[model samples]
Target: MWHLYQFPLCPFSRKVRLALGEKGVSFEMLREHPWEARDEFFAFNPAGRTPVLHHGPKGITLIDSQAICEYFEETVDKSPLILGTAANRAEIRRLVALFDENFFADVTLPLLHERMKKRLVLRAPPDSKLLRQAMRLAHEHLDYIDWLVDNRRWLAGAQLSLADLTAAAQISVVDYLGGVDWSGHEGSHGWYRVIKSRPSFRPLLSEKMEGIAPPSQYADVNA
Candidate 1:
């Protein structure tokens, strides 16, 4: 059996969980906070990150969300997340990188630092100025998502892929922190609604972080 070490609000961890869920892989969860800097956790990943996948009997440990997702994609044949033509696969990878890097940096990371880490670790009030800035950036990102949804069936192409999982994971975290403003982005909002309704996304919606409460609409698939 595989044990996934992750905290509730970790977007990368959520991405891995979504991929595993869609691929029909069963694993146990081990809540881990990277900020705690536990020695045992560091042993599993020298970088000391969450979402480390460990197989005790097989002695296999996977670190990094992209690497772990790819590991499963290659090994498991049930659901192919990076499927389609080479161009389509490339598009999937590109969008995955966009969400995992650009969107996270512009929106999710700021929200995590201001909303989550501040409240939990620093015990300080969130910065309103920074929060506003993050929300503005979020709108920008959502605009791009709106454009993509308008153009394609999914973020990458026709079929559901890792790109959708990656974007949804990041967006879910932002929405949890109350950073998303879906007013002008109907296309993105509709797309997100569909993603949120997926069975693979249900577990994430039900989970919560200590000292934090998601907006009521965060868990409502119909909203």
Candidate 2:
């Protein structure tokens, strides 16, 4: 069985989880509070990040969400969530990379570090500058998504590839923080509602921060 080192809250970890579900791979969760850095888990990943997968060889550790997801896609079965075509593969990778780099760098991380982290861990709120920047970047990112959903059934196009999972995972994190103004875009919200309703996405929607009540629609995958 594949062993996954993950926390319930990390979006990076969550992406891998979604990918695993899309690929129909079964994995055992080895939950970790990576900040504490136990020697056992630390030994597996020197970087101390979540979504580290142990597969095949006992000691081989899979690091980075994209790398792990692509490796599995290449090596495993399940109808090729991606493609053998260069153009198609590049498009999927481009969206995946964009969501990780552009969206997370400009939007998601700032909000997560500034707002959600403090709320979840009972720490003082982060800088207002961070929140302002995150809010601006977040809205910009969502507008781009609204256009994509308006133009295509999924991010990057149809056929339910890693592109969709990548965007969904990113959006899920924002939803958890109530950072998403779902009512702003009926189409994106409706698309998300459908994605959330999927069996794989059901587990993601159910995730809640400790001591924090998510919005009513959080678990209402159909909503």
Candidate 3:
């Protein structure tokens, strides 16, 4: 009986959704447009962000994707998303930070602001210059991911961790905007394909935003 307020395209929200699905936790998803700053939503989370979770069993509300996912890991204890020994956990957390902070800062946020948030929420024209910059940075981020997957089985290491879900959540949003050029990044593309094929990822792949058509390959695991 968990309730999650989330925007379909928001990476942070998507990350939590992926985590919940991967862990076999069922919850109700309430679509919220945070830009509207609804008062009811604010009552639940003062920060007014999506991906806020209401844990029915404990009657506690959780804000922030990182906190919610970690709390689920600690409470659920079924499928281990963040696995391995202390050192391995450290590495996994490092990569999680890399994508959640570094990748989003350089690529996801900027691109979404220009291509999505501006037009859909703000009702403003896209910034061409910023869009171009974000596109370039997106490719660089992809290259970095290619390098990482080239070395490790997953983003962090052999086991599938939060790092993989975190990175995929962000990248999938960008890919929906046609920002990802998956032609050359063979390693990363293959890794993504594997993740995309998972049953947990099916719901996300089926999502289609209003007035925004994703690329043909956006939902294709074999693409």
Model 3 alpha-carbon drift over 4 Å, by segment: none
In the range 91-204, model 2's lDDT, one tens digit per residue, is: 889989898888888877877777666766648867888777777777777787889889987777777788778888888887776677765777778777877887888786
lDDT of 3: 0.88
> What ranges in model 1 sit over 4 Å off?
none
Error of 2 at 54 (Å): 1.3
Give a tens-digit lDDT track for model 3, residues 1-223.
8888987789999999999999999999888988889999999888988889997788899899989988988988888988899898888888888888988988888878888887787888888888788888888888988899888889888889999999999999999988888778898899999999988899999987776788999999899
TM-score of each: 0.98, 0.90, 0.95
Q: Write the per-residue lDDT of candidate 1 for residues 9-42, one digit (tens) a residue.
A: 9999999999999999999999999999999988
Ranking by lDDT: 1, 3, 2
Query: Candidate 2, which ten residues in sequence have the lowest lDDT sum?
Result: 113-122
Distance from true position, residue 9, model 1, in Å?
0.2
Q: Which residue pairs in candidate 3 have backbone atoms (N, alpha carbon, C) closer than 3 angstroms, thus clashing?
A: none
Over 4 Å off in model 2, which ranges? Answer: 56-59, 120-122, 126-129
Clashes of each: 0, 0, 0
Candidate number with the higher lDDT (1 or 2): 1
Score candidate 2 by lDDT: 0.79
Best candidate according to TM-score: 1
